[model samples]
Target: MLALAGLLGLGGTVAVQAADTPAATFTVRQLTPETALRAVQAALTHCRGLGYQVSAVVVDRAGLPQALLRDRLAGAHTPDVATRKAWTAVSVKMSSAGFAAETQAGKPMSGLRGDPRFMAAGGGLPIEAGGSLLGAIGVSGAPGGDADEACAAKGLQAIADDIEF
Candidate 1:
């Protein structure tokens, strides 16, 4: 009987120790500057091939710019728009176009567009790998949002194998 009680007490102590353990940190994967530049370059190239002058921006997981590229003939407003689009994608872990569709006028999330950094555009895409969000890429100044999004997708495809691990 005493041995059983002792074992029970030991088990309780172990449980207490486990419960007291502190969860002090978490791990996150982010893209490197080289990878970001590769993405932007590929995006820009794709847009150029399509006869669209555009700006592309890559943002880290924290929604900070990692790399930006603007074609020679891109509009002056493109860089800013591209940056905001990347910011919006990383901030929400979703494509900016999907957000735009889901948050259009009269939708429950429509108010999200009111945020200065939230761009309801199609050119933004989350950069994901092995189920993790590594970053985002955005392209602007294409003839339309669909064209812009295609350029961004090309950018993501350029780095797909590199980030697959």
Candidate 2:
């Protein structure tokens, strides 16, 4: 019985040690400056091809704007809106459509929609690599959210080789 108790104590100690020590740390890879710039340029090209003046924004994993560009004729609010949309996507790690669906279903997003820097619309896309979220890209002022999203998708596709998704 004493031996059994000792074994149990040893097992408990090992379990506690394992729990205290982290097995691994998770690190998310982010987009490089060149890749981010390319995404913005691609967005611009796609929007121009559709004959729409638009703004494009790229945000880092933490939802901070890294790069932004607006067409000369784009609305004054285009840049800000695009940045907010990008922030929303990066924060949520999902497409704006997914976020909208969740919001519409009455899911709580920690008041993200109420935050000044968040946009729940469908013009934002999460930049992912190796099943990890890197950042997001948003396009705005393209006549409609779908149009803006399409342009953003094209931009992401342009950098598909460099990015994970």
Candidate 3:
């Protein structure tokens, strides 16, 4: 009986050890400079095709701005806003609408709004490929947020073949 009890205890310990092991953590890969430039250029071209003067921004996985450009006729702050919107999407790995929902649930992320680098708006989108997050693209100065988001989405779609997220 003693030997049987000891074996049971050992088995229980092994079970607990298995349960305690943490799951593997997946790391998001940052976008390369060339990929970032391509995304930005695509966004710019799309906006121009729409006859819209706008600014577009690309950000790496860490939410840092990689590239930002404003059309010559865009407002002075267009580039800044676009960069902030891109940063918000990359940092949170979600669209600005998701952030807004979280805030609406009494989880105030007003701190993000206060930060000059964050823009919790609809013009930003996460750049995901192969079920992994690569970064984000943001467009501003369009006629509306929907239009801006459309341009950004087109940019990501253009580089779909090159991105593995």
Candidate 3: tens digits of C-alpha lDDT, residues 65-153: 78777887888878887887788887888886566566553466655656566676778999988877778899998888788888898
Q: Which sequence of candidate numbers ranks them by lDDT, best first? A: 1, 2, 3
RMSD per candidate (Å) reads 4.3, 5.5, 6.0
The best-first sequence of candidates by TM-score reads: 1, 2, 3
Best by lDDT: 1
- Candidate 1: which stretches are off by over 4 Å? 1-17, 20-22
lDDT values for all models? 0.93, 0.86, 0.80
Pairs clashing in candidate 2? Answer: 129-164
| Per-residue accuracy of model 1 over 1-165 as CA lDDT, tens digit each | 687679887884323336778876989998889999999999999999989999999999988899999999999999999999999999988999998998899999999989989999899999999989998999999998889999999999999999998
Better of 2 and 3 by TM-score: 2
**Which regions of candidate 3 are displaced past 4 Å?**
1-28, 105-116
Count of clashing pairs, candidate 3: 0
Instruction: Score residue 77 of candidate 1 by CA lDDT.
Output: 99
Least lDDT summed over 10 consecutive residues: which range in candidate 2? 11-20
Q: After the best TM-score superposition of candidate 1, give how far the Cα of residue 115 lies from its true spot, in angstroms.
A: 0.8
